[model samples]
Target: MTDGTDARPVQTRRNLGIDLLRGLSILFVILNHLGLRIPLKKTALADVLPPWFLSRLNYNGYEAVFVFFVISGFLIAGNALQRWGGLERIDLRAFYARRFARIVPCLLVLVAVLAVLHLMAVPDYTISRPGQSLPGAIWAVIGLHLNWYEGRTGYLPGNWDVLWSLSIEEVFYIGFPLICLLTRRRWLLVPLLVILALSMPWTHAALRGNEIWQEKAYLPGMSAIALGVLGALLAARSRTLPARTTALLGWLGTIGLMATTIDGAVMWHLLRDGYMLLLALSALCLLLACEQRQRRGDWHAWRGLDWLRSWGRLSYEIYLTHMFVVFAMVRLFKLAGGDLRLGFLWYLLALPLCWLLGAAVERWLSTPCERWLRAALLRAPAAADPRQPASVAAD
Candidate 1:
């Protein structure tokens, strides 16, 4: 189950439930993008479905990114805790190297591809107002501030704009290790995470009028990440809950996730712009259920959902590359004289292509590069950590 070269576990280390959520989240992202390109109209299905329900189904892409953020925090914290025994004791160099190895290559390739598209004047890949950007979109991508750049300079193309989430995520990953070391004591780490979680409302509130910042601000995203970290710590320390208890937690979490993720979710005064805490806590509930299953060694694949699990495992690849598929497919749909009535067919064709592209990238490029970089950058631990049996839901 271990990859001997890098000392990381192989696919068997993958947790099924976690992958399922990841898969679902990425799919939501794609669905949202598709809906935007060719919006759902008064179809037979839409007519039959409740208006709110249809609306929720259409615009969940933004919420799905928050789901991914929570997952990222959980995986990173859980992995570090398992490997190093404590966050304070983490090997900073090894952590940085592994993260860099996994993240940088794909990023560079994405930027390079964007450059080519910009040169060719591809409609959805070209930067907007390059003059105002001073250096260019590449600078924002490299600086891990794409979200901020967009906030200041208006939007980039669809493919590049998607990197905004990456900026938010990478910023956390970059700072996480240092924060862990700084707050070595468990008491301090616990409260710091708590404070961040509690600050979610204010964080979002602070960005009140600014539409972009209201949605993609750093503090708001970090609040969710903080909740995820807390969830990991909680799951790692607690004993497996009883079957009924786990089920209850799972149901509660699932409902919360759906509430937040579904477009036009019930609005509260304090959470007008975002629902960071609710989404994170909901995700945490599911994580707790998944963690319990992991501990009980019953984390087997749910039959008929293997495709979703694969998507979950490939979430990172799919997330980064899917916009390319979306843009191309939409263009083709338009060229083929497609209309909103044919949107479903477009999705049917385009989704598989997205999966195919993501899978190919993983198999041919990212996976190999990740392995090589980890082997080169991360030193095998002094004592091999026991093949970590569970609780790694993955990033």
Candidate 2:
């Protein structure tokens, strides 16, 4: 289907399995928010679904985000290698131009809407905390440290709070190219990535009890990206796995992913801070398997997952704008006297609306703005180096 895992610039062709993983991860984010805003009770969903399956379906947002971190790292790094020939050969200005074009348009639109909403004194949209202000939040976002601000002052409104992950992603990319540049000079990039990623467990452990820091901190999040980079480097150099080996990895990934979701409470108790690291690693394995299988063009196209495929394709837009639909649905549910009986129905409505909003934003805003900015900003294409080989498509 050539469905890419991220809203990125370099796309020769994409793997279907990667799209499915992205789709699943974003779904987790939505379900997590839905459960957070209006707590899903046993009385609501347990009547039809089994307790184990229902448990898996609830509050999977954070783990799903880790999956994204890995996928994003894998795609961006793999694409860079395909485009520029090597990480060290990366062009800093061109890399930044492409990133700025793709990311900033939607980001600015989101924050502008948020600023207007907060100014209007909407219920859930307000920066109600005594310590938080509109200007401060905006500055934090600009500085790529929104996560730090939230850790110190407490959570912002739902719409703004989602930017925590973006903060982590921004900072990681800021360093990603720089690290690649350093590899050209003298330092070994592979070992450097390894050392940084190995430090992830300690980063997670250091702030184990701090809820905001654990989820939003830079080191822990960047580590996942590093692991993903390593995965890409490995895939670029390694031979494809045989069918049996691919099957084994596929089973391992599916079981581990499901266990983390379905028996989340159990995994939480067993792994604690290690839970996130485990999730990221499992994602790494699954993506590698998908990459190998995809190269052979041997994957089955499941018609039932087309909706999720759409979600994955528009994941970047959906991730930013879905919360607006969520809050609106919450408000409507409140007008309905906040009945739990209707909570499930709100989810059904919210998902399609999120898809619609995401589609509209992509068609009207993100894509057009990206094209305009790229034309204005770039003197040369980001992918072609002329000195390097042509960009190759990958999972």
Candidate 3:
């Protein structure tokens, strides 16, 4: 009896739930990175928890990265679908231009800054040891080849280890649009999703007990992205749900996510693959439920979380810049002869520091770069009409 138009919104606001989740994920990432070298034997939590728990909990930063991938895929794919009708008609140039503008400039700046810092702080460090020059370190970072020497070199120069994730993202930035362009058939998407899901386990098994596996895990970690695309597709196809049902699903999804995290350690190796699948599903379900609830005017509104959401909005900048602050802290602690240990207190201190650095970089560096890039990309005549207006376009 109801018309299709009644089921959809005329305009949609930003989803606060996603913002909150992203913010929380970034916080976890900072904690994980900061705690990497903390002696687990010294901590009560580590003592009480099983090895499985420690491993899973310790690696939760990777999970946060996966969640970001999902959000990216969902947002990007949703936009692509709306503009191109299944990607067949996508404007590849504009897509690539936008992606390059958003990612490359900041990345280049970070690499340059790190390079300069490495030169100033440790003039002797190099990609090759004993006789090589510090410029080798700069070359490794700028070329995104840090991972190649990570195992042999012990540590990446100047906290550039985190750039591995950025490298994976860059690869995706180049490849994902091509994927969409090549596989425009709707039927192919589901199969492609299945392949991505299957490929992770296969690749993991193939690379097990290998350092290369750990370094390249980000590339095979496309399952979350696939889940996000699925969520967007579901949103496009389905109607809003009843308020009570939406609320129930939201709670269920949240519980599932927590359970997945807690149980992930216990289920490591044996159920790691299953855990990822379940986590992605739970996140997707939560997103769907939240979307429905928002439509039905039943979504939760947390004022304190707005700050977190704002951080999430600037997460890319934060993620890219935090390494510099962490490296400086590490050096300071070393100079003071202080033991590097992970504790709740360390997180309390580091989190704020990371946020402050992120804010400063975003305000001073990323924002201006973004503005310039946007202006450049939006300047061309073809770019302006990359897609037809929705009003005049046909479904």
Q: Name the regions of candidate 1 deviating beyond 4 angstroms.
A: 1-12, 42-44, 130-134, 269-274, 379-395
Q: What is the lDDT of residue 243 in candidate 3?
A: 75
Which ten contiguous residues of candidate 2 have the minimum total lDDT?
386-395
**Candidate 1 worst ten-residue window by lDDT:** 382-391
How would you order the candidates by lDDT, starting with the best? 2, 1, 3
lDDT of each: 0.76, 0.78, 0.62
- In the predicted model 2, the residue pairs found to clash are none
Model 1 per-residue lDDT at 99? 75
Displacement of the residue 324 alpha carbon in candidate 3, Å: 1.9
lDDT of 1: 0.76
Across residues 1-395, which tens digit of lDDT does each residue of candidate 3 receive? 11111222223356667667778778767757666644333445655677566555555777677777667766666656665556555567656655655677777887676667665665322233553345655565566555544544555643576776665555665677677668877687667866775565555555566665453555465666776777777776788877777878788878867777767655556676566666767777777776676567666687867889776766777888776666555555556565533443444566678889888876777656654664576563222221121110000
Expressed as tens digits, the lDDT of each residue in 1-395 for candidate 2 is 11122233453455778888888989889888887877666437767767566555667898898888888888878877766767887777766766787788889989999999899998888998978999999998878899999998999998899888888887888888997886674248888888877777789889877888777899989999898999989988889789888878778888888777777778879987677777788888898888889767698879899889778877888999999999899899889988776578888899899999998987788777766665566653333221111111111
Pairs that collide, model 3: none
Q: Write the per-residue lDDT of candidate 1 for residues 1-395, one digit (tens) a residue.
A: 33233344333356778889988999988888888877655334556667566556668888788888888788778877776777887777777776776778887898888888888877877665744342568898899998888887777788888889888878987888898899899898899999987788888888888788678889888888888899889987998789899889999998888777663346445466456677778888998798788778876575899998778877777888999989988889889887666566787888889999989987777767766776666544322322132322232
